[model samples]
Target: MCRLTFFVVVLIPIIFGFCPPGNYEYQTNCYFFQNNPTGFSTAELNCVSIGGHLASIHDGFTNSLLTQQSLSFFNASTDFWIGLDNLQTMGNNWYWTDGGTFDFFDWSNGMPENLQTQNCVAISMIDGRWSNENCFLSKPYVCAINSAATTPPPSAYPCSGGFLYYEPTNSCYGVYTHQEDQTWSNSESYCESLKGHLTSVHNYAEFRLIAAFASYGKYAPWCGLFSNDGGRTWQWSDKSSADYLPWQPGYPSGSGPCVALAHSGLINADCNQEQPMICKIQL
Candidate 1:
């Protein structure tokens, strides 16, 4: 009788759908997105065209999963759109424009910097945070609709970079390079060919770390921020289409037709001039 009771207790959770949220691939909820490319606004519209609006981030686990997959589809102009917005004009008042309120939000240290006249929000790095920016900007963003959710492709990799010297846990990842320099097109091509994409520098810590590894003294390497708005907007090479803005003092000068990494080994470059390149791949 005791054994039977224990067995039933164990099976009760399975029967009642009472397992804790987990990281297992199967246990995770899946989201469906359109492969069609659209501008930030258009993407939102398209998402509405379906039954859903842009992708609304739910929780850390789900956000991380979405960000990881978003990075994989990234290219030189890979800033896909998401569902969060600051349309209310209040600073840091982010809500899913999809008409659903979000319960989970992650802000970087001193984030939502609101450094500029940002009105929209986008996801940065695998560590989820919302960036405020203009909505008119045309960056690649992901659009989520109501359908059977699906997992990201098997090739997906997170936006986080590996360690500099050595870390056992990071052995599966590779470090960003200081020696590699390629034209914007070439660099992007390089990453794609390797079944990887350009690395996204999400915050000051990440920017500083990658810069140090690249040995930047006064030169910057190319990163993944670009815009067709005559340099008015910058987007990472992902699908989050998160458009809140973050600029380090003087950035997106709006002068160059192209973007590059500059500022020593900081992966900062002038958008107009050709520079060396870096590529990221699974470790």
Candidate 2:
């Protein structure tokens, strides 16, 4: 009877997703820290592949929790990537990867400097405060799994108003047609306000779905692709892999901070140019 009780006590958590092994639970979420160092993009992908995203610091309590966990599992010299990043081309406003509002901030003194070059953020091992860094820099990272209800696929569930369910990707998409054109930065803000971001095309099928909604032979629409460091490195706003680019010939001139999809194909465009936009939400 004693052995059975002990086994049941240990098995309950795993059976109900209370907290997986090798993870710590704090306020309806599970967090895992990886010791291996990797770039910001790769780190984001790693977390997503495991059904989570990089940790998003909310308040002092959460910050303390993460800090204590880091100290417990890692050395004092270790720094782990968090989900906050400032990839928008216009402003230095940081956003969480989970699409939450930017309500809390805990930057170290004299930190988040060089806003133009440093786009990604990480938690410091010394004080557990936040600091901005170049996304290309490789580092260990923390993944956060929200304990809230799982998001059902588009086919399995319906989206809210103003969103169309795409069966192929199981995502909800919305097209924003503007009478007056807005810059890429402005469009991004608009989409975020609606709880989404500029559409990120991952494959030919997804690209075609977006294309079908676009006005034929008309101005292109802003997308999530852009040069993060002054045309040096291009990345998706959602941090997805950029392995499926289908740019038209002589396009992606690598001369602009924004990209748009026209009838011809994906093309580099000035970030300031006004255009229609597409926003996507993963179900």
Quick one: best TM-score, which candidate? 2
lDDT of 1 by residue, 1-283 (tens): 0110000001010111222232122242224444455445455544433324567776777777777776656544434457766543345466576556778776656656653455566676445566666665666666544333334333332223331211121211122333433556665665666565555555432333333223322244555566666655556664334343334445545456445443221223445454544443435
Model 2 spans with C-alpha error above 4 angstroms: 1-16, 148-283
Query: After superposing candidate 1, which stretches have Cα over 4 Å from the reference?
Result: 1-39, 77-79, 89-92, 148-283
Alpha-carbon deviation at 111 in model 1, angstroms? 2.3
Clashes of each: 35, 0
TM-score of each: 0.38, 0.53
lDDT of 2 by residue, 5-27 (tens): 00000101113346667778888
| Lowest-sum lDDT 10-residue window in model 1 | 4-13
